[model samples]
Target: MEKTPSACAMQWNIELERDLRSKKPGKSIEAILDIGPRLEWWSRESNLHAAEYKIFGLIPGEDKLFANAILLRLADAFKSGDKHMKICIVKIFLSELKQRRQLRGQGRKDEGILSKDKVDSYRELLTRIKIVFDSGNIEERALALVLFGCWAHIAKDSADVRYLILSSLWSMHILEAKASLFAAGCISELADDFAHVFLEMLGGLLVSSETSRTIRLAGGRAFAKMWCPILLADIAHKTGVNLILESSEEEFSLVMLVSLSKIASKWTPLIPRQVELLSSFMTKDRGLSLQVIALKCLRFILTKGMYHFPANSNVTLKLFGVINQLDFPPALHFDALRVLCKILPPNLDTIPCTEILTIFSKFLQIVEFKLQSPVISERVFAIHVLACIFDKLLGILKDRSGIGSIVSSRMLTFTFDRISY
Candidate 1:
């Protein structure tokens, strides 16, 4: 004479409502969940219900405890190798919330407006982890990441935007999905910690080689979005070794690196990290065949001037060392000339033995015939760098012989020929 599990859940929901209305303090989630005899079978559905309750009032507040509780539950699901549970939480709950909002429109007829239950659910989440950030521990860090990932919005004045997002600096996912969502009023919550957890999961995947493809690709896309923007302008830069190592296809590696360069273009300062990562693809990993793509991106990032991308002597010199060892597609040499213009100190062309300028000078004419008109986009890029090199070369025309002479003769003639309308 056992009650069916759904029947029991219905009963518990009734009792829980009674407890909530009575405003009782002793009511505990554990005690309620334990009410069923075969709790294991009912636990999954019950856990979902706990997460979905809307308890918080508007002017939503941060909750650390609830956030932790949710994360712990999710982590447990992951630990148990429960794919259905993981997909349910990540795809159905976390990701699908945003998707629902997209369908619902601002008024939310599609998914319906946030209910009292939904608001309270979020409030509980924020309240639990509220003060732990200042406490300083790995748990706190994890707590911060979860809250940030789950709810922190980037909208400037929205009631939901909890943190000042420097995410455009380091998070690609934020830039692509979150930025647009925040701006359009489509999304008001962000779990900023997804990147950290994702990175942690990725490292685990790298070690175990058993992680799902969904996890790897989604995780990488997430990291690439957030971290890409931050590495620009030379503050605390590091090479993107992940691109070369994680991406099996050389072309995919190139596409990713090129995408990084495109993001770096609007930089508030010079881009040194771009060079470090780009150098990894140079010469040796032709299979990492992104030079043309990377060059196009580099050209765009450097549209303004050589001064835009300030040099890291270490990265630039390493790049030169790599350049010295082998030959590349002549198109790459041309693009390298453009990158060198920005990163090198003003008179780097004067460096003896093997500066970029020397390579260009010794071989500029040699490769001239091979450097065909780039594709329309490529032509646009080459134009941008040509403008930069032309400006700088004009200044030192008297001191620099080969480049200035070639520019005076062949390049200026082309500009005039193309523009005479």
Candidate 2:
């Protein structure tokens, strides 16, 4: 006779219980691997709910067993298991940690807080995981870092636990490790006292000549997330104008530029200066890739600090110059159009109708030209830019019969012509 799905679940549950109860670390690891796949199965298989009741009940409440048996053996499993098995173990840790957090949130102190016996087991597990992080393969080390992050809440109250996590940030240099640590820092909301330390470390990695390109980029991203006014000012002063003018390393400069772009919203005082620097870079015969980045940084600045650039500002004209230049690539053209759209003042009343009309007229002419291009991508890009312009200025343009009628006629002719073809 064939077994029902329920029967299969029951058998696996029995085997899992036996494995969890076993003294050998390998058996406990096998049980953890088994539970990984069945987690979704147990949740979705309504018929197997009764069978799942015991295992679910066993796993969360048996913190001592988990800390001692399962977590202690994870280092070995991470070392020996294939990618799938290693992923399964990490999933199990995350699930259990989540449950512990939920229980603590609900005031179940007895279950959430470890007892004396379980405390020792938990400490041992941390030690073992740290060992894996210190000596394991790249994937293993990354996984270990994730586990440390999940446990960062515990570090809030325990000095030892806090030290272990902070120390791991220095020891792990891989990009993945850095990303994991930064994310964990965000979640843990590291105390202000330690924030500077973390920022300093990330800054060192970003500026260090010895750092690989990938690590440097990751470090830049990390620094952006942890940025504050004081730190930003410090970095800006230290790098000074040399960041744009004298930095011979293109990749490093690009990373710094991109990072600064993200924090534009927070640092309003520097917007005008950055606008001038990036505008100069774009107008020059710089690398196409660098120009694209500079355009994007300008876009971010305009989006965050639009009030700083009046319609007649030199910055606005510089942007127009970028758009009108025939030699620039379509990609730069598209991004410049985006920046222009962002430059439109939120309140139309602040700028005169003629000034706005002049801007729209220029935009409409560009769209009309690009819409007629033989290349499909250029035409598509033109359509997108047209949509963005209309989306931003549609209300203001509607009141101006001359430009509005021109826009309507151009769009209708383009649409019908394409359909007829």
Q: Pick the TM-score winner.
A: 2
Stretches of candidate 1 off by over 4 Å are: 1-198, 228-243, 246-270, 296-307, 311-363, 370-391, 397-421
TM-score for each model:
0.40, 0.56
Minimum summed lDDT over a 10-residue window in model 1 is located at 180-189
Error in Å for residue 163 of model 2? 4.6
Residue-pair clashes per prediction, in order, are 41, 0
- Look at candidate 2 and tell me the lDDT of residue 370: 69
Model 2 lowest lDDT segment of ten: 40-49
lDDT of 1 by residue, 1-421 (tens): 3433333444444454454334345443323333322222332222232223333221222222233333334333323322332233333233434544455333434221122232334454343333333342433333333433434332222333334222221233332223322222212122334433333433444334554443334333333333323432122122234544656755445545654564455354435566556655554455325655555555666673424444545445544443343446545655665566565536544444234454344333323332354545545554565556556656766576765676567666665665674
Q: At residue 171, what lDDT does model 1 achieve?
A: 32
Q: How far is each candidate from the true structure, as Cα RMSD in Å? A: 15.7, 8.6
